[model samples]
Target: MGFRENEINGINDLNLCDGEQAVNKTELIDHIATSADISKAAAARALDAMIDGVTTTLAKNDSVTLVGFGTFMVSERAARTGRNPRTKEEITIDAAKVPKFKAGKALKDAVN
Candidate 1:
């Protein structure tokens, strides 16, 4: 199955094929458990630990790079002026640090 440009409405429309569905955390945990021959609890714990590790590293303004997966890091967004739709008033948008992810070459290739 393929996606047409007009068919995509938003993130929720990402699964465009019949019998295809987005996999949630529980499904991921089940897959991990079956693949690793571990219990569901262990798989959940492992996933949580991995998430915590990435979060902690990003909190320190650092990056986490999985050789064939992706890199997660913090990116600084500059402050800017914006418009209010209702009032048509000018507003100042504050600068902030946001988390970003860049997929690695191997991950990109796998997807392609």
Candidate 2:
């Protein structure tokens, strides 16, 4: 199947498909378990560990770049206005530090 056919790839895979990389979470767990020869629980833990580790690193405002895969960075989102569609009321969206990934060349090429 084409990479586009795999929705569970990750957020990165999704972006890459739309010229962006977006892979879903489940697929990561499956990949971790299948490739590591570990149980799903173990894989889940490992995946969580990786995510937590990255999150922690980013929390400190440090960037993590996994060579040949992608660079994970913390991005600051400016406060903005938002609307509640149901209530039809305006709201202030607070600024936030968000995790972002820029897919590496290898990953981009592989998808293509």
TM-score for each prediction? 0.79, 0.62
Backbone clashes counted, model 1: 0
Q: For model 2, where is the 10-residue window of minimal lDDT?
A: 1-10
lDDT string for model 2 (1-112, tens) is 1124333445323322454465567766665565567998999988899889998999999999999999999899999999999998999999998989999998898778
Q: Point to the candidate with the largest lDDT.
A: 1
TM-score attained by model 2: 0.62
- Which residue pairs show collisions in model 1? none
lDDT of 2 at 11: 32
